[model samples]
Target: MKRSSPANLGAEKGQKQPTMEEDKVRSLFNSKIWDPEFQDTLKNEIAMSKPYNWGTIRDLIDDDLLRKVRKEIETEIHFTNKETDIYKVNQSGDLANLSGLDWNDLSRLPSLCRLREILYSEVYRDVISHVSGAGTLSGSKMDMSINTYTKGCHLLTHDDVIGSRRVSFILYLPEPGKRWKDHYGGGLRLFPSIVANVPHSDHSAKLVPQFNQIAFFKVQPGFSFHDVEEVHVNKHRLSIQGWYHIPQEGEKGYIPGEEAEWVKTNTSTLAQLESNVLQDYEFPKNERNILPYHQIRHFDELLAAQTSEHEATESSVDLSLLSEGELKYLAEFISPHHLTSAGIHKLQSQFVTKSQLQIDDFLNDTKSEVLKKLIKTDELQKECPYESVNVEAPWKTALPPHKWRYLYIDGKSHENFQTEQDILNSLNNEEMPNYNLLSKTLDPVKNNTETELISVATFLESTAFKKFLALVTLLSPLSEQVLIRRFRPGKDFTLATQINKNDLLERVKGFVEAVLEGTLCLTPTDGWESGEVGGYELYMDNQDDDDEANTDIKDAAVYRSDDTGDSVLINKPPSWNSFNLVLRDESVLQFVKYVSWAAKSSRWDITAQWDVKTVDDDSENDAE
Candidate 1:
């Protein structure tokens, strides 16, 4: 490999020519790194590694020089905390194109400029190529950034399969000589792919990084799944992340169309994973497969009994004031205000116009106080038992931490999987865990419910409460699932997206298909001011060009920082005794943002969903 001149050093009009001192400063890498024997050993190790081909080298740079570089970076560089759907970390602006910096810029941080050159030098590139067998790397086409993951910062699962990328590497610069402990988290965890694009739920390997160590891997599209574990303590995990690109034109090993070919193959693998065969693994898992005939009949009977008793009224019905039995059942948890005639009228009118409603002080004062106290006690007193195998019953952690990670009552007894293969096999067999059985077993009213979680689930699932949902939405409930969720600080989130619709399911007469969702929030602390520290439920209008009618629906967002046209229909933050109800069509996107580590307590909520039937327009009119 031939070394290219630094991008910023070449002479411009009235600028001084490159000097010998600059060249000497750039050659700061450890010379022993270029030895043939070392390179060969690294190559063999990478080829033999499990999950993926990756290797790490210790003391790859001159220690004194690296220390100097780290000091310069600490004193001179300004970092901005950046957050997005994929990552949350403090980072400096791009350091890759440092050659474009003027002399005045370079003069202030000479060590950083030299460090960039040393990492991208021909000698270092050759060694990297020999070890990883990633072909020729570009010297001129540089790409690198400095990032610091302090407490609670994390990067979720992703393959560094972006444009023109060939290899990826991270050089750690944690406090020198003081070993970065495993319990402090911030390890680079690697996931094994089930197939090309499908990654398993958990990471199989992890590298606990230290100062002066560089971890590099060939950038395998779809297969290179990795994430930075959330830093557990108030410590900084600083590193330089960069990529070696396929050689550009005029560079050795440059092949026309090579980059394009890699991109095409990567995109095809992603498309493959999105096919119907893999829908079972997707989050929200296949649109609540229809209930069995016996189960449906049971729910139908509940509705039928209610229908026989309440005669059709000429004016709008008050869902708040239900029959004596129903109101009594609901009063155990539901707020009196929400059940009032005026409150019911307000909620019904909002839902009629907007398809969603948010209710605060959702639970009656006495029940709300008990539930909140129980939840707060659980959060403060109970230690979360998260294990790779043999996890405790009633609560199971949601998997594929790339998507979401929270303790949820799957409504079933917890089953443990010892390995990625065990999980993959379970998924392949289509073994849907019986969350309903778990719910039934834990229902406080029905069984030995030892906790508020069980009591909440039981209340949400009561026939009377389901009837209340029907009255408010004017949609008859058929099948339902209720989950008591605990989103621990620094541990959980769900990304925004619409549910997949099953077009094949037949629509029942006098009914349109919809999912009725209700969430009763029990977050016990403040500081969830807006969307910051997350744990906010957001609803956005689905962008679907196929629906011509929806084209006129302005693009919007709930928690938008700026007024761009994306429509955000609703945004609700975590609050005590708050409840949100949304009647969703297939065209609405919903998600709860990740809770930050700074939260004083976990976000507690009882989530319920019902597959419902909409009444015919004439019948609705008659009921009104």
Candidate 2:
């Protein structure tokens, strides 16, 4: 399941082999594997297993045979490096293709080919079914693959609910006779469910696997949530991961339309993604509420009248857009260079060329120094809260771990949103982001710790800030949302996702299916350049321009987002006092990668989004 795409890693459907005697099948496995007393004990353990029905077996295969099989794999197979939003590892091509190999191919990997036959053999399936109570599994539907999780490799949490998989198993092939310790990482972690479909953030159970042992569980939709812990040491955690599926057309337990009906119920979360169904369930929705009434009324008309429909260039700053008093207010937070004509002209050229811009030292030195010290002090002294009860009001946790989970200040408090109704109440009677109001009300002396944060946030929400943005992007903003966010090390991440353009399209007459987004990263730490420890913001092109779906994506719901791939448009790691601005459309999928537990500190940043209208450039084009 930690693959780039869905895989049916098995050989062709196996026909029932009535001629193969029970003795012959029994001889293929370890002498202890098929013992009725041993299986009965395993069955009882599985029935009482918490989280889900899962069990393990040691020395499942014959020792000499397995050793030969491992040797063949080493000599014959080639593993390819893969990185995705969810996982990273090196894996061989589907072992299912092993069954279809020509005579020449089979000769090269004879032991591997022979091992596959024994595993899919009908008698073996019966043995597995009996112990796990998985009634009548198909010997044909063997989906498996060979993979190795070396240093830094990992898989995130999710239920193994893709397609019609009946059971999931992992056979570890670490060095023979060696003990894999818990601290070495690469453990198989299982999470208990808060409810039937929702899992708790922390894992309650873990498996520190051993050589030649296989861990297995039934594929229970919503309940079987697990993840592979990242391997920390410079050693190989080689293993074979596979799945058993419902019977095919000719298999013994096959039923009419059984597979199709199963697929309807047990599809990937991705299949229903980008639709309103899943999004409506997302808590603390990414909704950009309107700015405060006073700010809008005081400056909306003047700002609107000042905005021209002309294209920007390396031209002089528009001093008329900001009055002398307004410019003075902005200068306190923004760098003097950014306020000058030369700075504006340089930004104009960058935006015009690539529709994006990145500016270091965007904030004035005094403000930057204050932020760096405040943030670094908090990271060093304050212990971040991990539980929901500990997360205070004003700052809330983004919910539904499958999509995202991070601490954020969204400028309003509705406590926790539990259902669609809760979201509706908030949306219908909208509460806008009022950093200015929060700054005015917060007790400066009592909350001296948060004073500078509020000051920075208030400035970001200022009308002059929007004017600067409009000048740079040559667009007009109708509504905006500002958030102060912290991606805590080891606990926070957002999956790859895109926004609904239709939502923006419905708001204004010329909405243009676009949003001008900005992030002012304030993380104060080092060693983030390589991205091995996660905590990077990435943007990817979702699909081809003509709408041809990516072939690599299948029903199993995984993506191979190699860092160097063409799909990646941007990858930005956490840094101090840097600002990035982009005018992005719906086609761009964006996310913050999971922060590793090994990271020095939290990834801190202030994010902003604007629903903007592209102005007419007809007059400016004529002048050019």
Candidate 3:
């Protein structure tokens, strides 16, 4: 049924009222959008929208019809749990397949079917295209799916630049009578770009949707970056997400080769990002700065001499070989129990078998008490910085945010990356690690949490720590990165990512390549042990699959809806004082889950990584 145009609805005052066809058109969508003045306002709003060209309208769908549609969705749809490195949500199979539904589904979803038709109708498409200035849209190729964001569901930042999609939209359908508030979470957040393809660390604006509201934007590649904030409460957030495709053949305004040109111009950013070809644009670049030449040579010489002397043989490694002075330096940070010969033997044996270990009470009593006390007090007394602008001296936010977002102290003279120029300057003037400056600046006597953490990061970089590491893992360190990271409640995380195989292989010359990873968890909270409230360290076999249940993901890891089973080899929740060590190859993917807003405090930890090599004669296979 064709709806009358706005010109037909524009009858002069006291002349004739809207025609019957016009009334039908006005009744489906909110009547206000048919007004010339309102359309003009919407056009201007889209033109001036920040981060990208976008606009939203409240009460877009007729309330009664939408409520019926929501009920049909609730009753008829089978929502599958969809998860990935960047998002987690319950998703329905494509609504475009509504006609192909089985008898029960088809009979139960009449209102949903109507809603879809009205949405893709020529009348509605015209309003969207004209307002957003997207030239044309196809009615034939309807691409849409339903998503429900329950508690813990989230969608990370991405510019919706897929093939032929000219405009993107989401029509919200929360509980009909309830108001979705700002504090409810699940807000649609827009991020301003630091440069093309580089979104800032934090969102610039957010929209808390109400029932029958619709938010949309022109698909502007490299500029339209947005995310759905994780829903924190137990409320169902239902939405219809769809893209208006560029006109297809025989459609009005169709242009040959337009889509192909657009596709070539806007290649998937994920492919380029995974390869790290755009490293310069990435903040806190994943590049691991090598230790000084003398230090590298020292480890090389130590490994060669140890091999020649038949020390730390294939059977076991002896930590007791450490000089008294070496033991004393480590005693300040690591528990003496972990330094004993028995401790080293047990740990080595376990690592030799499993290639991994998680040790509790990893720190000495003095250091543990000091750090725990300081962290707890700081949480109670000090406010955590929620904004990059509020992030004080010494710490920097990990960015462009598609990859990760957390606060870290890299033991460098920190500068805020406020603009494209700031980041460019950093790339132009890169420097190597300097623990000397870190020691001179952050005083251990300050009794401050930040300073204490920085001190720990520096200590972890020391030769003494590496000696103990070499003893247990039986791999000689070639290069390393030690970072003191704070995964703030509600705001920090690392998306799942594999170690760059090419980079690690290049660093480790010929014999087997591996990276030794260690996590020292110092979180002072309590309710995170179950990994239910987030803040967990997870490692998975990247080569595995989620099975045929999810065929869309080609290179998937086997996963249960709750993230259990053999795929997840290790899952450690936020803890008081513990250390986890693992030697992993490029096939392993690792990430710290995003901490929930309900958590008591930030998930504080010191993360350490080292590129290493196997001894020439040993033939033990990888234990992963």
The TM-scores, one per candidate, come to 0.77, 0.87, 0.87
Give the winner by lDDT.
Answer: 3
lDDT (CA) for every model shown? 0.66, 0.72, 0.74
Candidate 1 lDDT, 1-624, residue by residue in tens = 001111112122233323335346345666666678877887999999868999998887788878887887788777766554445677664343354576456666777766776776676788898889889998767667777889867776767665567898999999897999998889999988766555665788999999999999998876888878888788989898887878777778889988777665655332333344445444334345454545344444444443433346423454433568878778878788777656665676677677778888888888777777766666677775544343466666665444556667645555454455655665666545454455555656422323555766767766677666765665666566777777877667765555544454445554455677889888888889756577888777755444332111111111112124355677788988888889887677677777777777888888877776654434433222
Q: Write the per-residue lDDT of candidate 2 for residues 331-358, one digit (tens) a residue.
A: 8988898888678768877886998889
RMSD of 1: 7.5
When summed lDDT is taken over every stretch of 10 residues in candidate 3, the lowest stretch is 1-10
Candidate 1: worst-modelled 10 consecutive residues by lDDT:
1-10
User: Can you write out model 3's per-residue Cα lDDT over 1-624, one digit (the tens) per residue?
Assistant: 000000010111122111225446567888888788999999998899887789999999888999999988888777776564566678675443553544244466777766766776778889998899988887766667788998888877777766677888989999999899877799999999998878888899899988999999998877888889999889999998877878877779889998779877776555557677667887666656655556555555555544554454554444445778988999999988888877876777677689998889998999999899999998898888888878866678988777788998776667677799988888877676565676567656543787777678878888888877777766767678888888887788887777764353464443346678899999998999876568898888766433433121111111224334557778888898898999888888788887777888899999988877664433222111
**Clash counts for the predictions, in order:** 14, 1, 0
Residue 259 error for model 2, in Å?
A: 0.3
The local lDDT score (0 to 100) that residue 173 gets in candidate 1 is: 96
